[model samples]
Target: MRSLDSAREVCERFHPGLVKALGELTFAEREAPGSPVIDLFREHGGVGLLVPTEHGGHGADPVQAVRVMRAIGSMSPSLAAAATMHHFTAATLYALAPTEGRLTGAQIDVLKSVVPDRKIMASGWAEGRTEQNILMPAVTAVAAPGGYTLSGTKKPCSLSKSMDYLTASIAVPGPTGEPELAMAIIPADSPGISVHPFWGNDVLAAAESDEVRLENVFVPEDLIIRTTEEDPERMEALQLAGFVWFELLISSGYAGAAAALVEKVLQRRRGSATDQIQLVVKVESAFAVLEGAARAVLDGVDGEEAVAAALVARFAAQQAIAESTATALELLGGLDFITSSDSARLASGVRPLAFHPPSRASVAEALIAYCAGDALVLA
Candidate 1:
C-alpha cells in the first residue's frame, strides 16, 4: 500500500501548479461564497483528473485519485468536496458504460472536451424529500418522441453555476409502467434548466452547492443511461461501484483536512512531544486504513467486500479526524483559536465529514448484519 507521505509527495510533484494555487488561497478566501479557486482548479485540469489518458486526462487509478483528493482536502475542503462530485460522476459513468455498452461514445466526447474546453460537470441527484437511494432519483422523466422531459429539483447540487454539464438521476416508466431508475447527461444550457441559490450556510460556501431545478428539460435519447430489463445485474454492479468510489474518495478528502490540522499543530510546536506523537499516530493510522481500502479497490476487489471495506475505512478515518482535530485545537490553545481564522475555519470544516451519505446511524444495523455474515445491502 502507498504511504500517506508518498501519496502527498506524488500529488505535489504531478500538480505543482494546483498545489501552489491551493496553498496561496487563504482559508478565509477559499471558503468565501463565490471564491474563484474552483475556476483556477478547473483551469489546471482538476475537472479531468479522473479522465482516461487516451482522452487527455491523467487517468489516475483509485489509489492515485485517493491521494490527489487527500492532497486537495488538506489544502481546501470546499474544493475537495466539490471536486469529489465531479470525479465520482465521471467514475460512475465510466465504470458502468462497458457493462451495458452505454456512454462509450459519450464518455469519449465528454472526457476529450474536459481538458480542452475546460468543461466542468456537476452531479444533480440529491432530492431532499425522497426516500429513494442515491442511485434511484425521484425526478420524473416523461417519454418524448426523441428524448425525455425531466421535471424535478436536485438541491445542494455542487458546482451549480460553473458546470457545463450535469449528470443527474431520474425515474422513468418501465415496460410495466412502474418507475425505473435512470441517469441522464444533460447540458447545463438546456432549456428549462434553472439554477437557484439554496445553500445559504457559511460552511462549504465556495462549493457552490445550490439547487438545480429541471422543469420539463428535454434530454436527448443518446444521453440516457439505463440497464435493459434483461440486464438487472449490471445496474446492481453500477450501484455498488458508485457507492464504493464515493465513500472512499469522500473520506480521503476529509482525512486530508484532518491531516492538515495535524500538520498545523506540529508547526506550532506548542504541544508536548508525547501529545504530538499521539496525534501523528492517530492520523497516520487513519490514513493507513484508507490506503488499505484504496489498495483493495485497485487490486480488483468489488461487490459486497468493496462496500464493506469502504464503510469501515470511512468510519475509521472520520473518528481519527474528529479526535485529531479536537486534540490539535486543545494543544494550539485559546489564544490561537481566538486569533487564527484559518485554524478556526479548519476546525469547523472537519465537522462535515459526519454528514455525508450513508450516515452511521442509518448503516449501523446493516454493518452488524454484515459482520454476522449477512449480505451487506446498504438500502
Candidate 2:
C-alpha cells in the first residue's frame, strides 16, 4: 500500500481533487455507460496531464505520469483506460514542438485548446488489434480541394462519446502517387464523423470504447502531419513514441486495479502472513518493472529501445496481474465474492490489459530478434 499511496500522492499533486472526485463515485456508477467519470476527468484537468508546462499542462515526467495513471486506475479502471487514450495522444504533442517544425498552424491551433479547454482526444491509430499489423494506417485519404476526405472505422475507440478531437492514422498520397502513412487531426464534429455501439462488455464500459466511423470526412491540409521526405523514418518514430507511452500508462492502470484488490486483502488480513507477503512481492515487483521502464525513457532512451522497455514492463505487469488477482480472489474466498462486488469488479477490470495493442504474441518474435542484434521491426 505504501507504493500505491505514494503514487496517489503524486497524482494529487498534479491534479488536485481528481482521485477524491473519482472516489466519490460508486464502482458501479463509474463502470456504467454514460458514466460521469469522463466529465470529472475533464473538470479535474486530467485532459492535460501529459501536456507540457509550456502548453499549460502539468508537465509531469515519465515517472510522475505513470504514478498518476496508477492512482487513477485504482479508483476507476474505465476512467484510467479512457484517459490513457487521451494522455498518449497528448504526449505526441511534445514531439510536434514548434522548434521541430513538424506541426501545421491548424494542428497547433487545435492543440492549443487542449489544455485550456480540457478537450479530450481519442486515438484512431493502433487499430491493429484486429488487423494483422499494429502499425497499419486505419483510413484511406482521397485528395480533395483543400485537404482530403477520409472514410474508415476505428472499432473499440476509447473516449468515443466525449472526445473533442480524433487523432487518426491514414494512408495519404506519396511522391510516387502511392499510399503513405500519415496522421490527421480531425475535429469530432466533422461532417461525417459518427459513433456507434461496439463495446459489448461491462468490465470497462465507462471507457466508451466503441466504433468511430468516418465517411467522407473533410480535413484541412494544415491539420495533417506527415513525415518529411528527407527523414522517411519520422512517421514510424512518432508511432513508436506513442507506443511507449501507451504500453506504460495503460499497463499501470490495470496494475492499479489489481493493487486495489490487494489493498482490500491486506486491510482485512484475510490471508496468512506468507500469503500477504507474496501478494505484496508479486504486485510490487510488477510495478517496479513498469517504473523501471519509465525511468529508462527518462534516462534518454528512445526509438526501438524505449519501446522494448515498455513492452517488457507491459507483459511483466500482465503476468503479475493474472497471478496476483487470482491469489487475491482465493484469499477473499466465497464470502467476499458474495458480499461485495467491488473485489470482482476490480479484478475483472485488469483482465483486458492483455488485449491491448502490440500484444505479446505479435511482438514476441520481433523482440527476440532485436535481442539477437537485429533491428526491432514490429510487423
Candidate 3:
C-alpha cells in the first residue's frame, strides 16, 4: 500500500494532478473503447516523462518511470499499456543521444520534436517469435532510390488510433549482402500506413492495440539506424535498451492493475490479517523486484545483465500478479464478484503480462546459458 501511495505521489510529482484527473472517471469508463484516458495522459504531459528535461521533457529515470507507470496502471491499465510503447520508444531513441554521430540529423529531429509536439510513438520492434529472438526482423524491405520501402504489419500495436510515429524493426542488406536488423522510424500518417482492428478482447480496450499495416511505406536512409558492429550478437545496445525498458514498465503497470484489486479488498476490510498481509506481500514483492531492476539500470548495469534482471522481475511479477489477483478476488468474496464485474476485469488485465513478448519459456535457454558463464545469446 505504501508503494502504491508512493507511486501516486511520484505520478503527481511528474505530471501534476494526473492522478486526480484519472481518478475522476470510473474505471469502467476509462477502460472502455475510445476512452479519453490517452487524451488525459497527453494533456498531463505523460508522453514526455521519459524524455530528457533538456529536450523539454520530464526526464524521469528508470525508477521514477516504473513508479509513474504503476500509478497510472492503478488508475487505467490501458493508459499504462499504451504509454509503454511511447515511453520505451522514447527511451531507445534518446539512448543514442549521448554518442556523437550515432543518430542521423533526421532521427534527432524526431526526438527533439517529441516533447514539443506531444508525440506518441508505438513500437513494432517485437515480433513475439518463439523460434528466435523477438527482435529478429519480420518486416520485408526493398531498396529504392534514396531509401527503402518497408512492408509488414505490427499487430496489436498500441496507440493505433492516436500515435504520431511508428518505430519498427526491419531488415536491410549489410555490407556483404546479408540481411541485418535496422530500425525504421516512420510517420504514422505516412501515405501507406494504416490501422485495422485486431485486438478482439475488451479487457484493455482503451489501449488501442490494433493492427498497423505498412504497405509499400517508404523510410528515408536518414531515419533508419543500423548497428555499427559488423557481427554483433542478436541483442545490441539499441535492442537491449528497448527490451529492458519494455519488461520493467510493462510489469510495473500490471502490478498496478493487481494493486487495484488488492486495494478493493483492503478498503472493504474483508479478510483476516494473515490473508491481507499475504495479498500485500504478493503484489508489493513484485513491485519491489521491478524497482530493484530499474535502480540497477540507473546504477550502470548494461547489456545482458540488465536484460536478465528485467526478465527476472517481469516473470516474478507475472506469477505474483496471478496468485495475488486470485487471492484478492477471493478475499473480496463472491458478493463483490456478483455485485460488480470490475474485479474480474482487473484480474484478467494482469494476466497478459505472462503472454507479452519474450515469454518465460522462450528465454529459458538464454538465461540458462548466461548462468553457465556463457555470453547471453538470445537467438
Candidate 4:
C-alpha cells in the first residue's frame, strides 16, 4: 500500500539489521541448508519491487528496486543474487506478457496465495546455440492437446533449489532458422522439468546455479509471452532501457558490497597494520567512483548519462571489491592464503566478475557510445 519511495525507505530502515545478520552468517555453509536470509526475504514478501500491485507486489519502480538491491548487496552478495533473480523474473514477465498483463484471474489468485508462502523464484536462460558448448540446448516447442510442451535446457539459473517459480527462455521453432524466443513460466514441481546442479560449491555455494531441463513440460498458451521483433530503433531503445534498470540493480548492489569490503579493511587495518594506508586509499578511490556513479544513476541525467553512470558504477564496484578483498588478505597476512577466511571466498568471487555479463568491454562500448553523439535519444 505504501509508495515506491516508502517501500525503499522500509528496506533502507531494515538494512543495518539484515546486514549484521548476513555478516554473522557468512562463514556458515554456502547455502547453509536453511538460511535466515531466505527467511528474511519471505518475511519481507520476497522483495516486492517487481511484483505488480494486482499480483500482491508493491509495484515499485526499477530505480527503487536498485536501491533495495544495493542495500541488500552490501550485506550479502549471495542473498542479493537470490533476491535479484526474483525481480529479474518479474521484469521478464512484465516485458513479455500482454498489455493486460500475463497473470490471469485464476493465475493471480494462485500467485497471491502462493507467493507469500514462497521465498524464491529461479530463472533459466543461456542455451548453447553454438557447437563446442555442451551447455546450450536447442529450444523446442511441440503442440499438446491442452497447450504446448516446452523442451530445452537453460543454464545458470540462480536459486534453483529454493525458488518456487522457474521462468525460462525457449527458442520456439518457426519457419525462420532462428526460432522465436518465448518466456515459459513453470512451477517448481511441474512434471517433466528437471534441474541439474551446475556451479560448484565455492563462491556461489550459498546461491545455487542450476541447469533447468524441460522435457515436454506442458504449459498453457496463455502463460507464454512471445518476444516480438521490433524496429531496430525501437528495439535499441528498449534494450537500453532494460540495461539501465538491470544494470542499476546489479551495479549498485556491487557498489554497496565494495563499500562493505572497504569498511572491513579499515576496521582491520587500524587495529593491526599489515597492508599499507595506500592500499586503503586505492580502495577508497574505487568507492568514490562507485558513489559518484550511484548518484548519477539516481539523478537520471540523460540516456547516455545513465548508461555511462551505470558502467562507471560497475567498473568501480568490481575494482573496489577485488582490491579491498585483496587488502583483507594482506591485512590478515597468512590467513587469506590458507583459503579458510572471507578473503578466499571473495578472491574467488572477484575472478568470476571478469566473465559476468556487462563485461568491461561492454562497459567500454557504453562509454564510447556516450562519448559519441549516439548518447542522444535512447532511440
Candidate 5:
C-alpha cells in the first residue's frame, strides 16, 4: 500500500483542508442518514478536485486523483464514491472537449464556474445495466428549435439529492433519424427534473444513489455533446477516457476501504504475525497494480492500450481486495464482527468494487480473445 505520508501529500496538494475535516468526522456522522459530510466536503473544495487549476480548482494528474480518493475512502467510502462522480463528470467534460479549437462561451463559463461556486455535478449515466449497454443512453431527446427535450430516468444516480448540476447521456435522433448517443449538461434544478429514492438499501445511502428522472427537460444546444458517425475514432477515444477514469478512481476508492480493514486488524493486534504479513502483502499488491494503471493513464499511452491495462489492473485489484477484506474479517474474529460497525461496513463496502463497469464476467471472453491477438472490443 502507499505510504501514509504520500496519501496525506496528495490530499494536501489537491484539497488542503479536506483531510483534516474528514478526520474530524466520526464514522457514524459520515454515514448517518443524510449525512452532512457532503456539505463539509464542499466547504473544503472537495467538489473541484479534478477541475483545472486555471479554472480555480485542483488540476490533479491521474495518480494524484486516485491517491486522494484512496485517502477519502479510508475515512468514508460513501464520500469517496460520491466524490468520484463529481471528479469523473469534470474529467469527462474536459476529455470530450476539443483540444485546440475555441469552446463555446457557455461551455467555458460552466467549466470555470464549477470550482468557484463549489458545484457538485452528478452523473446521470445509466448504471446497473449490462456492460454492453454501459454507454448507450436510456433517455431519449427530441429535437426542438433551440435544443432538445429529454425524457429518461437514470437509476442509482450518485449525488442525486446534493448535486448542483448533472451530466447525462441521452439518445438523440441522428441525421438518418437513428438513435445516437449524445451527452447533455444541465442544472439539477431544471424544470421537470426530479429525484426519487431508488437505491432501496443502506449499503451506500450516504452517496444518495437515487433515481434522477427527466421529463421533457430542455437542454440547450450549447450544453450538448455529440459526435458524427463519421468520427468513430473520436467517439472511441472519448469512451476510452471515460473508462480509464471510472475504473481507476472506483478501484482506488474500494482499495481504501480494504486498507481501512487492514488497519483495524493491525490496530487491535488480533491477528497472528503470519496472518498480518499475508494480509499486508495482498493489500500492497492491489495498490501496486492500481498505481501502475494510474501511471499508464497519466503517461498518455495509446487509448486502447490504456483501457486494456486499466481493465487488467482493476480485476487484479478487485481479487486482492476481496481476499484481503475477507481475511481481515476472519482475523478480527466474530466478536469484533458483531460489535464493530466500521468493520462490518468496511467489509460490505469493499464488495461494490466488483460491481463497477467492465465486470470481469462480462468482458472475460473479449479479454481472452485480445490476449490471443484479436482486436479489443468491449461491447
Candidate 6:
C-alpha cells in the first residue's frame, strides 16, 4: 500500500547531513570501529523517521524504509545493512507471530501502522556449522520457569555492538532428540553475553559487527515470540522464506548504490567522449532494472510469490549495481579509486554485496527450490 516517493523524500532530506559527515565520522569508514550511521539514525530517530506514529514509530511504510536504506547503502552499505536488518526481522514477527494477546487488534493496528518502539532487534537463525551439510546453530535453549535460557554464538551480526535488542534462535532440544527453533528478544547487555568483533578490514568500514555469545542468558516469557513443534525440515523451510525476504531488502540497497554511482559519474561525463549514445543507453537500461526491482518490493505480494519477486529483484539489482560500479570506476579512472571521491565511497559501499545473507549459492538453491516445487526431490 505504501509508495517510495515519501521515503525518497525522507532520504533526500537526510542525505546532506549524512554526506557531510561521510568522511570525518568514524562510522562512515567501513573499516573504522564505530557505527556512525546507526548512531545518526538513532539520534535522528531514523528508524522512527519512517516508523509510524501509532506504536511510537512514525507509521512509515516499507517503501519509505526501502528507499531510505537504498540511499544509505549508496553512500555506505554498512550503514544500510545495519539499519535495515531489524525491519526484516520485524516483518518476520509481524508475519509469523500469533495474532492474539500482545499482538491483538489494537496492537496489530499499531504494528502495521506504527511498528513497536522496542529496542533494535536482529535474527540469529544461522548456525556456526552443519552436519550432512546442513547448517545448525551450536546454541540451544532449555526450558526454564518463566522463559528459556539461550546460549550460543551468533556471528557477524550487522550492528551487534550498537543494537539494544536481538532475536536469536535457540536450540530447544525436544522430547524427541531433534531440536526446535524458537525466537526470543534478548537485551544486548544481558549478563553472560559477550560481543566480539568479527567482520574483516576489507568489508564495510563503519560496521560494528561482532559475534554474540549467550551463556545461560535468560529470556523472559514475554520475550519469546514464536515456537513450533512442527517438522524440523518444514519449519526450516518457513524460516528460509523469511530470510529470503531479508536478503531481498538488502539487495535493494545495492540498487540504490548503483543509482548514486551513475549520478556521480554522469556529472563529470557531460561534454566528454564517454557520454556517447551507446554509453547512455547502457546506463539508462541499468537504472531501469534497478527501478523495476524497487517496484516489485513495494507491491507487497504474499507467500512464495513475494519470495519469487524478491529473488528476481535481488538478481536484477545485483547485476545492475555490478555493471554501474564497473562503469563508474572506469569513467573516473584514477580519481575514482581515491578515498576522497564519492566514487571511492560507493565502490566500498558495494563491496558488502559479496557476503550478505542468501549468499550466491544459497540464492541459487532457493531459486531451484522455488521453481521445482516441493515434490521435486534432489538426487
What TM-scores do the predictions have? 0.93, 0.97, 0.96, 0.73, 0.94, 0.77
Candidate ranking (TM-score, best to worst): 2, 3, 5, 1, 6, 4
Off by over 4 Å in 4: 1-17, 20-26, 30-36, 52-55, 59-64, 94-115, 127-139, 172-179, 227-242, 271-309, 335-340, 362-370, 374-379
Q: How do the residues 83-137 of candidate 1 rate in per-residue lDDT, one tens digit apiece?
A: 8888888777766534435555765576568767878888876523334456667
**What are the per-model numbers of colliding residue pairs?**
0, 0, 0, 3, 1, 20
Off by over 4 Å in 6: 1-8, 12-31, 49-53, 96-98, 102-118, 127-138, 173-178, 228-241, 270-300, 336-342, 363-366, 372-379
Question: Which portions of model 2 miss their true places by more than 4 Å?
Answer: none
What does candidate 5's lDDT look like per residue over 78-179, in tens digits?
988888888877887876444544346777778878888888998877655556435666677888889999888877888989999988778777788777
Window of ten residues with lowest summed lDDT in model 2 = 126-135
Candidate 4 RMSD computed on C-alpha atoms after optimal superposition onto the true structure: 6.0
Which of 2 and 4 is ahead in TM-score?
A: 2
Model 6, position 294, has a per-residue lDDT of 45
* Candidate 5, superposed: residue stretches over 4 Å from native: 96-102, 130-132, 175-178, 228-232
Question: lDDT scores for all predictions?
Answer: 0.80, 0.88, 0.87, 0.57, 0.81, 0.58
lDDT of 4 by residue, 27-83 (tens): 444334345676666665654567677756676655556667755665666676667
Superposition error at 125 for model 1 (Å) = 2.1
The order of the candidates by lDDT, greatest first, is 2, 3, 5, 1, 6, 4
Which candidate ranks first by TM-score, i.e. highest? 2
Ranking 1 against 4 by TM-score, winner: 1
